[model samples]
Target chain A: MPYVNIKVTKENGGLTKEEKLTLIKGVTNLLAETLNKNPASTVVVIDEIDMDNYGLGAEQISDRRKAGK
Target chain B: MPYVNIKVTKENGGLTKEEKLTLIKGVTNLLAETLNKNPASTVVVIDEIDMDNYGLGAEQISDRRKAGK
Candidate 1:
């Protein structure tokens, strides 16, 4: 089983259930179609992270958004 | 920057804040130490998932636990 984890900023009150389901299905399908992994066994977990808790290029995504750069 | 995502069953009421912090720190340190990645730029997101949503070996973890195998 291939465990896939997706991380996204908890913006806009986080993702809706439909978005989460779509993601789960899409990732499962892609892995199954490309990697030959069994879709029934593939697991996908989505994480809604606080912008402050996530950093990229040594700066938090929130800060980047604030700076508008 | 390396982004590490961790997924665990939402058992035992999920992990405590301290546990999540420890996991984030530990994974960040490991990646920095071994991969030469900047700890300041590394991101770690831990997802506590429902057992029913996670599958392994073509079976849900919850089912496995119930079967006591």
Candidate 2:
């Protein structure tokens, strides 16, 4: 089984349950269609991290947002 | 930046903060040393999913656990 994990920043109230379910189903379908993996056995996990906890390009997302870049 | 998301089952008590940090640091170091990616630019997100929400081998982890196989 393949476990897919999606990470998104907890900004703008984060994703609703419907959005998460959509991602889960969409990703499951993609894997099943391309990799031939069984959709019934695939798992999808979504993580909503705080901007301060996620960094990229030597700066945190929170800082990047503050800079408006 | 490379974002690494790890998924684990929340069967017992969830991972301790120390365990999470260890994983984050270890994975970051591995990526930095192997792929030459900047450690500061890497993001590691850990997700602990409920057994009912995670499936493998066409069965939910909760079910598998209950089966004791």
Candidate 3:
């Protein structure tokens, strides 16, 4: 089984269910095409994190965005 | 930076925020102890999926659970 996890910053109110579905389909198809993995056994999970909870370069993502860096 | 994703069935109404936090901290510490990764930049996310969406042996988890197998 091929398990894929996607972590995305929760920006702009995060993604809609339709968008998440699109991502799931696209990633599954990509693994099938590239790795010959069976889509039937492929698992894709998406995680949306609040910017405040995400850190980069020892600073929170919210601070980074605020600094425009 | 190391990113970790945990997938669990949405059983018993899923995990509480405190449980998730414990998992995140435990995983971060594990990575640091075993892999020399920095907990500061580590990211951990948890995804809870409906049993109906998860399949095994070409059978949906919901169905398998219903069969008591």
Each candidate's lDDT (Cα)?
A: 0.79, 0.80, 0.78
Question: How much of the true contact map at the interface does candidate 1 reproduce, as a fraction?
Answer: 0.23
On residues A14-66, what C-alpha lDDT tens digit does candidate 3 reach at each position? 87655666676788788878998897887766678899999989999999999
lDDT of 1 at B13: 78
lDDT of 1 at B29: 77
Q: Please provide, for model 2 over A1-69, each residue's C-alpha lDDT reduced to its tens digit, 9 standing for 90 to 100.
A: 889987788998999989999999999999999999999999999978866555555455666789996
Report how large a share of the reference interface contacts model 3 reproduces. Answer: 0.05
What does candidate 2 score in Cα RMSD to the true structure? 8.1
Task: Tell me model 1's lDDT, rounded to 2 decimals.
Answer: 0.79
Chain A TM-score of each model, in the order shown? 0.90, 0.91, 0.89
Tens digit per residue, CA lDDT, model 3, B10-68: 87788999999999999999999999999999999897876654444444455657899
Number of the top candidate by DockQ?
2
Q: Give stretches of model 1 more than 4 Å off.
A: A1-6, A11-47, A50-69
In model 1, how large is the Cα lDDT of residue A31?
Answer: 92
Q: Residue B69 of model 1: what lDDT? A: 57
What does candidate 1's lDDT look like per residue over A1-69, in tens digits? 899988798987889999999999999999989989999989999978866555554455666678994
What is the per-candidate TM-score for chain B?
Answer: 0.89, 0.90, 0.86
Model 1 chain B lDDT-worst window of ten: B16-25
What local lDDT score does residue B9 receive in model 1, on the 0 to 100 scale? 92
